[model samples]
Target: MSRHGRVLVAMSGGVDSSVAAGLLHEAGYDVVGVTMKTWDYETSLGGSGVSRATSGCCSLDDMNDARAVAVRLGASHTVVDIRAEFGDWVIDRFQADYLAGRTPNPCVLCNTHIKWAALLKRADALGCEHIATGHYARVREHGGRHVVSRGLDAAKDQSYVLWGVAQDHLARTLFPLGGLEKTEIRRLAAEMGFDHVADKKDSYEICFVPNDDYRGFLARRAPAVADLAGGPFVHSETGEVVGRHDGYPFYTVGQRKLGIALGEPAYVVRIEPETNTVVVGPRSALAERTLTASGVVWGKWAGIDGEARLGGRIRHRDPGAPAVVRQLGDDALEAVFETPRTAVAPGQAAVFYDGDDVVAGGWIDRPARAQPEASPEFVALPTL
Candidate 1:
């Protein structure tokens, strides 16, 4: 690999990104570190007068930490203000999804629409040919096309959230820690005297919601969501009135704890925002065999002319299931799992994989019919 070109490193003040910048600099590349100011901590946190240290990424403390690391590596560092874009793309979409009775994956949206998109533009403006980040994923070139594959560390693989990244952008994106495990990355940080963030706790909550109470955050940010009238919880099959729910947005599909006293266990089978109703049933009712998705993004192997067998995952932590995937149109696809799976929720992404490589992915549009009368004819779309 040539090391003479300039590369922009998206630093998050964490050990992962900090080590990424250091590794690139050691490789003889001219590295420039940039941290995105995604939001104002105080304002986003409801101006609770809390310290920035407790807040998540893009806080003042994080910026300072990133700057200190850049100084240690003798690299230039700058902060890019992306608060408005972040709000418009990620935060607003999050609230809207809940209001529409669908669980949302904000991380995937942020990676595709906000973080990488912003970094790529800035990298071009700074005369950098490539942009590097701390994402635990790998990009490989095969047969003249770039493909995104799972990172070496399966436990830390982030390729799921990155399926939305376009093929062209993957060509110039870099994941410095893709080949290394989490433990190795920490050890390298420690050996390089970056002890400050070497052991920092990994942030799992949404950055804008500091307390991680998304329900409370939505109530405050979008009050209309809270004012939705309480509705009845009905049984999916029997259509019997079981109990009442606080609101439709408060519950999610397959949630067992419906807060109502029932003789036997019950699970949320479906959420109907139109009727302001919550449907609950026995755990067996949650099993689903088919799901339809929209906003599909194909990976390296594009232009599927027929049904293709691939692995599908509905949630981030789910062990993928075997399924037959077929493109329905330009932006839609249908996946029929070989066996029934549970907790398949709408608005979550359905990512398809061929072995370790991400083949294609899309947003779950609706609960598909268990068995379509006939499979839709496949149509070949433009290759990415």
Candidate 2:
């Protein structure tokens, strides 16, 4: 029914992507399924061990499932090797962020740089007019500008990680699973006779990091992280050395499992990577009213000037809070929350929203710092 001639779909060997490919093909689009080989478990682990399960993306088993689904749909499928790109863009950035005492979300990087950017290029080379994925998000064109919106299924919405996607690609991108819920997708897959992946479990762990043990992965991949001398945990308020830690790279901001028994519960307030030290404080000290972020990507509103009232989410699961966002410089913005938020960690994405639509987003540059209350003139408007 649609006008698209040839479409390239990124099949992750999961029920969602398989169903997406099927739906697109049934709708009269020439679908070509492509699975990206991001990492090899044996090579990443240096052959020390093999993964117990093959449920995650990029695994040998996932590729096979993807191929099978493509065959069933009567579509062509190919495996693209992206291991080198994944290592440099995702793995290296993850290790370096931790080494610099910041927690990094490799999934966000992978989705923005690898999944969409790299695949879009390949789609063009293969004479495909559009590239589709299984992400639970929606894209719409309003007033001739492409906008990214949250999926109809709130619980399964994946728009948070997709805010960094470039605006130009939005027109050429398709999210076939955006309007449907996970339950409905599974039901459709079953009806379509995709029983092999219909009941498959979703992967939550990082694909390259086996067993979800990031600490161990970093120790093996980047041994220099261990050579850094241990430092003392300094109390933020009292300014006294309370305990010692193995190394600063092993910890993250807002972490509570320091292994040191301070009489009162303390959380990591900030990490000083330059001095290899961690600042700890009581729970109350974690509240923050303001945060500065960099790498600002204005998804729909690209060139608006001055200040704007918006809802800011520091993490993916966060419900979001009212804030006034003001542009600080070319690639930076400062957001002051109406009410203080807790555990606003650095190196995490801070996405802004105008109702259900994603307005803009950026990476948190540092741990949340204390700031005075917002001025009355900059208060955010109430959400409808």
Candidate 3:
């Protein structure tokens, strides 16, 4: 029997995951590497004449690379087909969110709903005690709860995207690269004789979207979007139709390049899908002090009793700002920032943090148009 029991590691044919599996195997754990086939590159080309070389993840080459790594370590590897699940949940939601004029983070949704959930099911079937990944975040038991915290590498910290991992899944999950930096992982991969994956480039684009062109992907997925094109870009402050955009779905909140010159700088402040209107305004108009979020997933605590001051992130790249969060209902809450956060995009994940540990997170539903006055006391904020 292995010293640490059987562990199922998600190998994505990347340096991080490969190194993670290597480390686990070297530590005397019965490691099983699995590469999930989430999408097919040929059909995902969207008739854009894009080649398979431009594809990011879940490719045939990736699967073969993962198998090679497993063979090198004398471990077992399996490729599971998850294209149907991914399409029904992640891809469908991606297309639907664009049609609804909301910028959806497909990676976040995949991780929360499909990726971990699927991995857990596969692990159970394989008699594995735990499932591991290459994500740069730490999970530990804290205060009788499984808490996720930021990785040591701030530049590569992925805790923002991992807030939706439920407490139960987190208990049986592991992040081997959480304590190590990217450079260390690369170096370790080289030291372990996996030269092919030691310097593999990280794939940033969405798996199914070729060349990071989400606008084109949406256009191809939903042909009806063509009719929504040529919509009016109304000014947020003056309520005047300043320009016209190809489509509201193609634009996201805080997008600056409108392809039309307005004599001054302008950004998308809001998108009204009901009217097929894209609201544009000066940069100042993009600042939002408060936002309402639904589908709350509590992490550190079951629920927030009252108001708790925490750092709230509106998007993945956001550094987060000081905010006081208050639970409004069973699965809804409002966040009042100490200072205004720019481009509070609806349909994006709003993750809250207490120090480095994730407190809870939810999908942003609405952001208040008026910037409420910032005060030292949280009770002074107005109701939604």
Candidate 4:
């Protein structure tokens, strides 16, 4: 047997995965390329929004693209049907979050449940020792334990959405293309005569919803959203009625383009699903000092000792900001910033970091009742 383990590369029918599969093959690993037919984009009726539940995997074009690359790379390719699994684990949860008026990250959910979860199963069935993907992230084993790290290129690093991945999964995962940058990957692919992938533009918008109209996509996928429409939009500071919107869930915090123009430039300050109100405000009100997080995964908080200070990044693109993190209870953490950070949104997640090591982190709680920063010393969460 070769030193390289049998690797199962999860081909998403894209240039990234195509290069990853080829690299693994060149490294002398017995490789199998697997493209999951997670959802049928054709049946969903052409790029409609509601990317989570309605239809998925972009379209037949994506699947065919993956198949062509796998054959060219001299690897056995298989399409594993996972429609039912995606619906249960991914789609249903996506619709559920939107209806509840939270801006859920479906790709994070897919990485958590479907890609790593489902593909890992196929790897076991094929007796493959590891599974690989085109994700721009890397894993390294240090001191007898596996650790996750950013890819070679900062622009392509996808470590944020992968926080929930298990240490064992990292140990058994291969990221062949991670050591290279995007330009290098494309250049290498073209050199190998992979025609379509050479000029392929990476898809940044929601894949299944090609049109990118999420509200209409939701209405078409789940009519429940449309039923909860025609609510009042309010000014955040004054709580004065500003305009009417179809739904609060349709908008995300920190978004400025979609708002109805007021006399001054106003940002989305808050979203109240129960009251069906979307609050807008001037930019100043958007700054926040402390954000509450729950669902703490104690296992992933490796480097932290007791109380530790760290930087936190709520969104993917953020450079992260300095914050003092303290455990409130067995499962809750409080993050207070040295200075307020702007455009922090509630319904999204706030992932914390202690340097490069992941200290405990979780979902961002809705804005808490404001007490003066000096009004009182903060208290730990009351234990049950």
Candidate 5:
């Protein structure tokens, strides 16, 4: 009990986080449960006002769920209005990246700029020395430094999205679900007399787009991008015009639906917003060995630099493969792998690692064609 400090728990009105708050409160630490008003998905969806937060974070329903948990646990709870911050840091970037035809990782941006930055600051103001969340990841400190580690549940590990976060944040952050699996977390919630979470299905949609329709959201938020419109969808090999689209931003790499069907099964290989073109290719072209990355954060591996070879997961679900990382410039790096990977889409994140430790990460750019050029300008990144 004395080993832990006062913790500010981030409640998403979900079982995992609410139970996290309960555990900390039961463990003798002063715990304040706080929910962030992270996004205005309702406003984007043409709702009159706030939609019922029954399913999404920061919704009225979510607020009630969080408030209910606080009352049940006899812990104080408050909601912080972070809508504007989330808008600038996450929503705006989401829109822009789509307009540019580069798939964006909004969760990564939100965690880096919103949760730890906005919410962590609020925790400090509330006299809390540590912050806790429902994340299914573990934190370990070794040799006077902190490292974010995988939780027991590999399928739900969110560490991939959180690699950009620093040790300074990890030192002050807590993951209550790190040790316990999802089933046990709910069981504890039920035992604590919390029925709201007895069988809550995990909310999985991009928090801002629950229905999974980003085009409608995009057209409303970025009218100019809509003006730019979409161009032709073409077969990668034959360059045959197969179909047309309203916007390339609406699609993702490896997406099959909403795409013009070729005689053979095809996947999205590239989306060039400049030409408003979507390149369709056979699955084989998706295999890529390397990715050039930018906007890196040295979360675990800080002093170690120069030719850092490690395993990598280009997207969250893919297995880590052996790869090498070379610093292109101060802010960018070119990553080459011993073997090729499929669907390594541009504009998505390619996170590097040494075993489980997140060594570094950045945005994946288009791979060099044919030659596998080791070094390009590693071009100075354009201001985002």
Candidate 6:
């Protein structure tokens, strides 16, 4: 019998997860480690057009490492193959979003729809009270609702990707590394005699697309989209076709290299699949003051009361910017940034935060060049 109760810990064979599992075990919890195999290395092709094994989280080596760590912790380990689910929910959405001329954040979708959903189901089957992972974010009860907050490690805070996690799932989820920094996690792993695990580098690429070449991956997966090659690259400011691009689907907003020499520096400002047009212009063209988002899931508050003062992070690496978010509908909201933000891509997530705590998040429908609609009830609040 354990003091805290049984916990199902997700171990990815990395130092953070390994240390997380060890910490839970040391804290007198009955830890059952699970290594989720979301992709197959033998079938997935790298950017080199070869099916080769790699050392990422999805590889067999990672599963083996996770099992070894579980054994050392005296915890039972299981390898769950969720590749089918992963492909259906994550991979298909990724390709579909790109084909629709939007930039999708697959990591957010995977963490919210696939990983947590799978873990909760597994935890229920295993008679575990809680499910845990190595994500660097904190979950707590605020105002009678579960809210996710930024981690202690600002550099590695993963709260941006966790915005879409449903409230019920957030209530049952636990992040063991929420309060610790990466250096501390590595030190803990080293002290546990897992020096190799401590030294392992973090995996940044998509699990299925190991080469970090998304353009190549798209071409290989949907060969028909290859026909979209030789699309026109139009200038956003001036109504002129500057050059031709390999394909509109292969390009994402904010990409600098257009493969064509434009006299001045250029960036991809927008993508239009309807006409197979890739809009390019100066960096100034990417700036947008208003953003409309859909598929919103509220965290800190059930919904925005009138206009809420918050900060919006358009991408994972964004430092965040002050914004006023207003609920447009049940599942949609509009955010107007105090200062125009550059590269506000559609299909990417726009996560709103109240200080360090997540307020709500949604997929950006589009960044509006126009200002917010004038209404009698709309009153501008002080900057967040």
- lDDT of every model, 2 decimals: 0.83, 0.82, 0.86, 0.71, 0.75, 0.86
| lDDT tens digits by residue: candidate 3, 179-289 | 999999999999998899898899888889988988788777787889988899998888999878898889998999787666788999888877889989889889889
Clashing pairs in 3: none
How far does residue 251 in candidate 3 sit from its true spot (Å)? Answer: 0.6
Worst 10 residues of 5 by lDDT: 373-382
- Which residue ranges in model 6 land beyond 4 Å of their true spot? 46-52, 370-384
Clashing pairs in 1: none
Q: On a 0 to 100 scale, what is the lDDT of residue 179 in model 1?
A: 96
lDDT of 2 by residue, 297-321 (tens): 8777774499889989998888889
Give the per-residue lDDT of model 1 (tens digit) for 247-359: 88877777887877567789988788777888888888889899998889888677467999999999888889999988999878999999998988888899999899998
The local distance difference test score of model 5 is 0.75
Name every residue pair that clashes in candidate 6: none
Candidate 2 deviates by what RMSD?
6.5
Which of candidates 1 and 5 is the stronger one according to lDDT?
1
What are the per-residue Cα lDDT tens digits for candidate 5 across 1-384?
435777889988888888888888878888888888877755765642325543355567877888899888878899888888787668777876776667778888777767887767888798889999999888888677787777778778878888777668888888878878877888999998889976877877677764656776776676666655457888888889888877677777777765467766788877766577888878886777767877777666564467877888888787778888888776678888898888876667888777777777777766654222122122221222
The TM-score measured for candidate 1 stands at 0.93
The lDDT of model 3 is: 0.86
TM-score order of candidates, top first: 3, 6, 1, 2, 5, 4
Q: What TM-score against the true fold does each predicted structure earn? A: 0.93, 0.92, 0.95, 0.88, 0.90, 0.94
The stretch of ten residues in a row with the least summed lDDT in candidate 4 is 370-379
Better of 2 and 3 by TM-score: 3
Which residue segments of model 1 deviate by more than 4 Å? 47-50, 369-384
Residue 289, model 1: lDDT of 92
Off by over 4 Å in 3: 370-384
Runs off by more than 4 Å, candidate 4:
46-57, 298-300, 368-384
Error of 1 at 127 (Å): 1.0
Model 2 clash pairs are none
Number of the candidate with higher lDDT, 5 or 6: 6
